[model samples]
Target: MSRNIEIEFKNIVTEEEFQLLLRTFHISKKQFFSQKNHYFDTKDFALKKLGSALRIREKQEQYELTLKKPADIGLLEINDVINQTEANMLMNHSVFPSGEVKDELHKMKFPIDEFFLYGTLQTDRAETEYKNGLLVFDHSFYLGKEDFELEYETIDRDKGEQFFNELLEKLNIKIRYADNKISRLFKVIQGKKES
Candidate 1:
């Protein structure tokens, strides 16, 4: 298991704007990478109530469990790698891998035994360098919903905020509130269950 601080800015954008940004940055469809996030939380959304998210992301042949929580600079991300069998068990709600991640959640008073797989989100992502930062483009789909987003990752929070806003303004894109993938997926899945 490993822990780290993540500082990234995201802006919601229309598909047209997403395409324009891609073309302007000379990024092509072939450059994108794809990943799937299998999300989990207690049935009552305990993690969501705490403004945290849990997911097992499958990228290429690798699987990682990630927990994200709110922090001063950005989000504090905790990650742990798991094998295919373990990932399958988690997805099937048959097991919870024990380790530092589970220990941390237990510390937060979450009933780790109640965790369950709820939904999955897929993202086609691409990244490039801009102004000493990582510029990212994402098109994600989940629970019959799709959206496009632009992101910038940087150590300089102030410059990142400035650069992200200016870039949006230059592209004539209005910033719309974009919830993180797990939260959005949970809302949709919960609604589905209710209906």
Candidate 2:
């Protein structure tokens, strides 16, 4: 597994603002790609209570298992590349790939047997470099719900925040309180189940 520190500034956007941002940045459909994210958690949201998340992402026929935990800057992400066969097993049979992720889970005191696939999210995304950071545009759908988001990822948190805040103001976009995609998707799934 490979580890990386993710420092990102994220905000929700309306459809009108989404389209405006795309046009403002000159992004096209050709520059975008799609991915399906399968999220896993315990029935009681054990992982969520601990401020952690697990998901297997499918993009271009490749699968990557990612675990995110709270970190000082943003979140610490650990990723493992697995085959389609393993991914299918995870979705169909609730089997997680055996590797650092599993080992780390055990180390973190999470009962491996409790986690299971809970929901899925599909996203159409476009990304580009902006102000020394990677600017990402995402339109995601899950559980009959859809949302648009703008994100900027960079190593320097201070600079990233400054640039991100100013960019929103410059674009005439209102600031929004945004949760991470997985958390938001899980909430939507939970809401659907409750209703």
Candidate 3:
């Protein structure tokens, strides 16, 4: 299994400051990538607001599966739909979803009420940090309603472990043991209340 280091904060930076900090961190706009927009004329299954979804994400020659549920957002239950799409990148290293891969998977056109964008920072590994309600994957980050974000991740297990240790030393965040089980950021967000 791949290893990862994740950190979440209360978003201490303003939108402008956050954008500046990303640049200071040497992040660039070119790294951002978007999935092909598709409208599904017919869905195999009618997606529900409170149901679970199994998602398989393919990125940078790697693949990961994630199981996710809807967030506490009201309305048409778009959070779960967005979560399933976001879970692929979060489960794999923080690389953006491959347009080609998304295209290959979406065989038929479907109605899309919303669109999602993601980016990655690759350095032997990746780190996805969530701050100020924005999911910053590596260098490129995006903000949207009902969307999910991931913090740092490493494809190399050893490097990931090192990053995790470093983060623990530097920040007062909690680390969850990474197991080959279903996982998602919403779970962490919801679980943080007890910790």
What is the TM-score of each predicted model, taking all chains together? Answer: 0.94, 0.97, 0.26
* Residue 145 in model 3: lDDT: 15
How does candidate 2 score on lDDT? 0.92
Give the whole-model CA lDDT for all candidates, comma-separated: 0.88, 0.92, 0.33
Q: Which stretches of candidate 1 lie over 4 Å from their true place?
A: none
- Better-scoring candidate (lDDT), 1 or 2: 2
> Which clashing pairs does model 2 show?
none
Candidate 1 per-residue lDDT over residues 82-102, each given as its tens digit: 899889988886487877677
Each candidate's number of clashing pairs is 0, 0, 10
lDDT (Cα, tens digit) per residue for candidate 2, span 1-195: 799999999999999999999999999999999999999988899989989899999999999999999998789999999999998888888787898888889899887777888889999999999988899999999888999999999999999999999999998999999998889988887787799
Could you tell me the C-alpha RMSD of candidate 3 in Å? 13.9
Candidate 2 to truth, TM: 0.97
